[model samples]
Target chain A: MILVFCELKDGQIRKPSAEALSEGRRLADASGKKVGALFAGASCAGAAEAAKFGADVILTAEGATLASYSSDAFAQLLADAVKAKGATVLLAAATAVGKDVLPRAAARLGAGYASDVTGLSMADGKLQAVRPVYAGKAFATTTFASAVQTATTRPNVFPAAEKAGAGAVETLAAPAGDFKSVVKEILAKAGGKVDLSEANVIVSGGRGMKDGANFKILEELADALGGVVGASRAAVDAGWGLPHSMQVGQTGKVVSPTLYIACGISGAIQHIAGMSGSKFIVAINKDPEAPIFKLANYGIVGDLFEVVPELTKAAKAMGIGSN
Target chain B: MKILVALKQVPDTETKIKVAADGKSLDPADVKWITSPYDEYALEEAIRLKEGKGAEVVALSVGGDTAKDVLKNALALGADSAVLLKGDGQGDAFAVAQMIAAYAKDKGFDLILCGNKGLGGDNAAMGPMLAELLGIAQANVIVKLELGEGTFKAEREIEGGSEIVEGALPAVITAQKGLNEPRYASLKGIMAAKKKTIEELDAAAVTAGAQVSALALPPERPAGRLLQGDASQQAQALLQALKDEAKVF
Candidate 1:
């Protein structure tokens, strides 16, 4: 059997969870095995969603201890689930929580694991995964030598296919485990800012924005277009925006937005590596030769200070919002 | 407190990667190697902890002779010592983590630090894997951290927010980019680093559990079509393209 760890957020299943489920279903079909899903949370209200993505059996672990994410506890629960189900292959979305818990679980099971994988397939009855290395500059096909194999798929790289399944839900007792480190509190973004990784549209600024003050203009553009604001490493290093969360680059968040607007950002290779997967790119800068133009579907070689406000006005006139 | 920072050397971010004749590896002829950018933040945080609480910082890397240069750079940046786990630099993350965990097992260090992920492999597995192997607490993608007696508090960046997590001593923490500003090596520090020796260990100590069967570059994106005309005209044309061509809006 193959098990997929379906991730939930705000009482709903995340997009990446569906993607993982779809991929898991594909792998199971190829290997002639059943695909089981494990959902650990206080509430499994959205557990049925996993079925739409081809989860045969949904294993729900609901308890006070599972209310909040604890790496140690989750790892223990997942290890137990894998053992109980006799799962030969395990998959999860390579989200923040998955990245934290998967490795620990793999260690517990003594399984070979790979994270942020983009491709999954079965070769000679063995699980194989294609993962990006060198920050997406190259790819490597990896095979686990262990009996139980595990991998996490990067979000937005895989399409989530909707297929009807049995959708049977089973409640499992939360695995009893000791926790050393716990999440004390979660400080959310102040203004309901869309997450850079999940945002469909992103407007990014770089050092060319001159200083922190100019970021307000980019913010205005983002607001007008119902998009989120992001900063390149140069802008983040210069303290031009939210240094911790809003930065998007190789060292920061890897985003695959539907539309990416680069304003006054020189296209550094590192920055491009993060946003290169966007469906459409538009670059606006004063330097005509800025490398960003090379990657942009539409390039505006002009002063961003003038072009951005006009673009914002145009977007506002078109009434684009959260579409 | 004794702090050990795991470091890695990667090609310069600007280096254009070229696949070797073997079709399985990168051609190293024109690649420029430097300490992984995120690792510098780990080194900086270690140095800062040392400055605040009289600790010894030891930098460690798992690679060949070229990796020694990264350790030397760490030494120049204020690490008291460095160690190189000698290898061909082709081992998987599990093997590398096991080797480091083995070396650190007996060492009575209170803290371990590393980049959230190495640019070379883009594998964010080592730190957490190492922590699990050592049976200790760990926090990854940490943007802010404060160390206390036998415990530490860290704020890790998540998708839409940050989480404040508390872990006990002997914990492993991976440094995010904004954790701290890495300092440059001064002339005095460079001279001192030149005199420092880097310890080496054979990679045969640990075995790999996973192997790479093949490697290839991702398909190149098609060249973009640049719009013509002035800024206003370009903006108008862009809106049109977004609507008619890309259909993203």
Candidate 2:
């Protein structure tokens, strides 16, 4: 059997978790094994949502202490889940939380782990994965050397699917111990915008945005396209967006949206390291010699101030994101 | 207070990655190696704590003699001492963390620090894994950290926002960007570093946790097409291309 770690947000399974579970279902089908969705929290309220993704069993590590994520506690829960289910493979989304917990869990279980892998396949009844090294400049085909094969799937790279399953809920005892770490508080960003890592479409600006207030135009265009607004390192450093949260570059979040529109971003090699995985790239800048055009699928060498508004108007006229 | 800072050396960010003659790894020749960017933040934070509270800061890394350069740089940055865990410095996150944790498990250090992730693998796993192995608490990818009496308050990055975490002493703190600006070594510090000895210790032999079978670059993107005409025409054509040609929307 394969066990998947499910991450929760507002008591609902996040998209990346669903994607990982979907991949788990695919792996289970190929190997003719059961898929177990492991949820570690005070409640398994949303475990049933995994049904559409074809989870055969829903294992909840429920207890008072499991209300929030604790490195040691959650990792023990994951390792115990794998042991209890007799699962030979473990999978999770390579989110901030997933990357934290799975690796610690692997250490405890003495398992081989591949983090943020874009490819997974069964080879000789074992899991093999392909992950980007050097920040996506190179790819490495990774194989596990331990008995329990564990890997974290990269977001927006794998296609999510739906298949009916039991999604049967089963409770396990959460590990009890002195959890030395605790989350004192969470400060949510204003407006509750979609996170850059999970967004399907992204409209990113750079130093060319001119001023922080000018980001409003990018916001307008992003909303019209049903996407999110992002900024390059220069803009973020210039306080153009929400500190560094909206930054897209080597030093920031690495994203692979389906449609990426770069406005005024000069395309530093560091910035390209973060978004090179995007399926399609559109560059809009005044400088015809900007390096961004080299990697863009389409380049519009025009002033972004004049060009972006026109694109927004066009999107609205075409009813692109009316739904 | 005693703090241990762990670091790794990786290719400079501007270096165009090239695959080696071997199909499964990076070619070292012509690669200008630098300390992983995040590790600089880690070392800088440790040095700040030492300067502020008169603590002892030691820099540690896993590699052969060439890796000593990282330790020398750390000393020049204000670390009191340095240690090189002798090994090939190969393998995944587990391989690196195993050597460091084994060496530091009983060192009685009050705190541990490292980059949230290295530029080389960019896995962002070693900090939490080291904490787990040493049975300590961890705060990862933290941009703001405040050391308290036997406790700490940290602001760590999440998906769309930040979370404040509190943890006990003897914890692992991974440094993210915005933590602090790493300082350049002064001429005096460089002279001082030249005289300081880097203690080298043998790392226990361990098998790699993961095996690499192949290495390859992503398929090249087609040559970018420059749109023709003025702003308005380009916008119209872009919409048409997105709808009909690229079909992204």
Candidate 3:
């Protein structure tokens, strides 16, 4: 069986986890294997969605220990689930939680892991994973040498597919863990804003944004485009009160948006690596020589203060990104 | 208190990459290696702890001879000693963790530190894997950490916000970007670091769980175009291009 760690947020299946489960479904089809979607918590409520993604078996690992999010406990739960099912492969979306817990589970299972993988396929009964390396300049094709293989797919790189499945639900016994670490509290952000990792289009700012107040214009543009606002490392580190979640760079989030509109961003290699995978790039800068112009398919060498409002008006008129 | 900081050297973040003739790895000839920036934060945190509370900070790295440069830098940055686990640098994160776990198993270190991830591979797996292999608890990508007698309160970065986690001593904490600003090696420290004897040790034979079959550059983007005329004209052309040529939104 190919097991997917179907991550959930607020009892709903995260969009990226759906993509991972669908990837598992594809691999299972290729290999004539069963696809199992495993959700860990005090109790799970999203098995139906998992089934839509082709989970032949919905496995739930539940207990009070898992009521709250804890990487230590979750890793133990995943390792136990993989063992109980006698699964040979494990898959997940490379979100913050997936990246945190999957490796620890791999350690327990002695599984070889490829992280932040952008591509996956079954080749001669083995899993071949492709991941971006060297700040997205190169891609490496890696394969697991261990019996149990694990990989986490990058968000937005894989599309989710839905198909009917048996949808048999099974409750997994939670592992008793004297957990080493526990999350005491989570300081949550305000709701309704799109997450940068999943946004199809991004309007990003940099030091050229001048100050945090300047970001309001970018936010207005982003809202019109049905996208999110992102920031370069320089802007994020400038102590402008920009949340690090919106940071796009080597040290921050690596995003693959469909349209990346870089405003006031001078295209540092660090920032470039994160957003280089965007399908189309647009640069708005007063200086024509900014490195960002080289990557942008459309460039406007003019002041952003004037150009941005006009662009927002145009995008709104076009109904861009609005479903 | 004794803290061991594990460092991995990667190609400098700015270097343009070329695949080697082997088709499975980077071309070493053109690559200039530097200590992964995140690991520098790990080393910096350890040094700060040493300065605040008397402690022994040992720097550990796994790689071939070129990796020694990273260890020397760590020494100059105030690590009391350094150890190089000599290997061919062909191992994956799991193999490296196995070696480090073996070395640290019996040591009476109160804590261990490493970067959340290496830059080149961008696999943020080693620290957690190492902690699991050593049978200890771990906190990863931590931006803030407070150590107590036998416990720690660490704030780690998640997607939307921060989560504060608490763990006991003898735990592994991986450093994130905001952990601390790493200090540069002073001239006096650099000279002293040069004279300091680095403990070289043969690494245990470990098996790599993954192997790279081929390496290739991502498809190059088509050459970009500069919009002509004034800002209004440029915006108009850009929207047209998006609708006709790019077709993105």
Which candidate tops TM-score?
Answer: 2
The lDDT of model 2 is 0.88
Per-residue lDDT tens digits for candidate 2, residues A1-323, read 99999987777889999999999999888988999998887777888888888999988877778876777788888998888788989999988788888888988887878989999988888899998877777789998888898999999988879899898888888778578887778888888887898889999999998999998999999999999999999898885455777889787888989899999999998899889989999999999999999899999999999999999999999998885
Measured against the true chain A, the candidates' chain A TM-scores are 0.93, 0.95, 0.94
Model 3, B124: alpha-carbon shift in Å? Answer: 0.6
Top candidate when judged by lDDT against the true structure? 2
What TM-score does chain A of model 3 get? 0.94
For residues A162-252, write the lDDT of model 1, one tens digit per residue. Answer: 9877878888898564566778899987886768877888999988888988889989988988888999888888755556577787777
TM-score of each: 0.94, 0.97, 0.96
- Which interface RMSD values do the candidates have, in the order shown? 1.9, 1.4, 1.7
Top candidate, metric DockQ:
2
What DockQ does candidate 1 score? Answer: 0.64
Docking category of candidate 1: medium
Q: TM-score, chain B only, every model? A: 0.92, 0.97, 0.95
| Candidate 2 TM-score to native | 0.97
* CAPRI quality of model 3: medium
